[model samples]
Target: MSKPSILSKLNSGVESSSPPMAHPLRQRVPSTAIAGLGRSLDDLAADSVATIDPALIDPSPFGDRLEYDEEATNLLLAAIEAEGQRLPLLVRPHPKIEGRYQLAYGHRRLQVLRILNRKAKAFIRNLTDAELILEQGAENGGREGLTWIERALFAKEMEGQGHPSKTIWTTIGVDKSGLSKMRAVVDTIPDHLIRSIGRAPGIGQPRWQELVDALAIDGAIKRAASILQSKEISSLTSDQKFVGLLRALCGQSSLAPHSGRREIRSSEGRSIARLSSTAKGDVLAIAKAESRFSAWLTEKLPEIYRQFLIEGATSTLDSERPATGAADSDGTMVVISQP
Candidate 1:
């Protein structure tokens, strides 16, 4: 089918004469864009708020990017077909186009209407950019609240828009402590884990955050991702051990006093780790295993990290790494070093 001219589609004659002020909201188009097209609302056809083609409308401008379920869409389409346009769509002027409108909210509703081939019942509003953002943010929030990834993206967007992180904390209704934790979680988790976090059974933000922080260290995220994906870490004991191993390797807490210095060697052929004889053999074994694991990770870690970027998982591992520093003293201690 031929696409309608932009002017014809948006410049319906509603603006030929100003309507009553009571409505406060009405259809509008850029005067310059549609100046030559003399159209009136009367000249355009109006369906009974039903049977209007919804495909003409576009997606939400906020980019919440909802995971639309076909079953839900079908149900909503059926309901809307039966009930007609009972709900009103909220929209704003498209940022890129002077005359085109963008869906600030009511995206799901609009989608269902489109499926039903009905005219979307909509409310026009003159809203500032800030208002549009807030409206769309809240609209996308809906009943289930935002996923960790969604929250991260939303918070990042808000930050970019000049809204302070504290404002987002307040706007999301999370306290300072909770907000702090969320930020840390978003910044520390591996993308793979972050994307899987909310949907992963029995995993919560606190635990996920802790894991993400640990995984920020080299190869930690990849190891965790592999264990989780393979279902090897399904039991509580496995989870605890995995987290413990990560803490031992990545945690910044002071290590126990040990006489021997631990050395980690990174090579293209194979990872080799050596520790002083003063260190217990058990500790040496752990360090050797860690080195081998690091080698395995050097080969596999990037693949796991790729899963995160493609999935848009909410987990974030801080990309920045601190300088290498380790201290040793005379005592028995455990060291897990990755090559």
Candidate 2:
């Protein structure tokens, strides 16, 4: 399908170019009719369109980082000061029935000129409401770049504005998969890591996502977050400490009694410990090198397995009976079954 024109897209809205000036004493030239050599400020104001105060103008629709770069602002101000207002900014008229006007673009220039004029006023063109909202959404949503914190906050605001997570991801123009992973990190990570994720270098969305996946273990999430926050480890890249830390988090200890480390994995609801040994003793070497270890395991494995089965059976039997007829803690006396 074809895309709607800007006005048609905004539906019932109109756009205006006038943002309220900081100062009321400013001269405005209408973009429509301007060919004279040297029009006086007052004559320019008289010949131009309507005037609106700066205070009445809405806050910038683009959110907090509006014209955030001071250097860029300075450059624009210099250009305007040197060349005067060459092109007019686009804007939409007030949507409300009672409001005066609203701005669509040229906010920075309007601000700068108002700073220059300090107290001048002049009229500007009107635009539709649809145009104004579109203007705000475009400026507010389309960012050139973002620091980690800024990106997170942007995501948060988008969520708050009832934008779907997918829509927010698409609107920001980032990879949908990467954005999905970042959202997962934001959702599942510990609070400390959440706060630290955007502030630390090398802790980008991908790294955070990986960390979240690694730390999803029970009780380990908080511990991992604490270790990450430790001052000694904070300087390390998230990736540097991540692998070893994740290994540690998986129940392997970096500082076990052995020269290497201990690895632990779950097996049938029991922790299986793998202990490493480095021995110079010949006897110890023989013990490790021989099949004796495997032989011992083979010999005892069935008994151990049978013991667990018996214990499980007894536990189930005990649980199935009523507590009122259960044996005493000391097993001195008991009824074996409920009536």
- For residue 100, model 1's alpha carbon misses the true position, in angstroms, by 3.0
How far off is residue 1 in model 1, in Å?
45
Report the C-alpha lDDT of model 2 over 6-116, residue by residue, as the tens digit. Answer: 345455476667898898986776421121212222323333444455555554343423125555568877887887766454444556635645665556666766656
Q: For candidate 1, give the lDDT of residue 215.
A: 61
Model 2 Cα shift for residue 123 (angstroms): 12
Give lDDT: candidate 2, residue 50.
42
Show where candidate 1 strays beyond 4 Å.
Answer: 1-53, 70-75, 140-142, 190-203, 221-339
lDDT of 1 by residue, 118-237 (tens): 677765556776666666665554433455556665665665667766666655545677767766766676554544333332335665554655565567666666655544334434
lDDT of each: 0.51, 0.47
Worst 10 residues of 2 by lDDT: 277-286
Clash numbers, per candidate: 14, 29
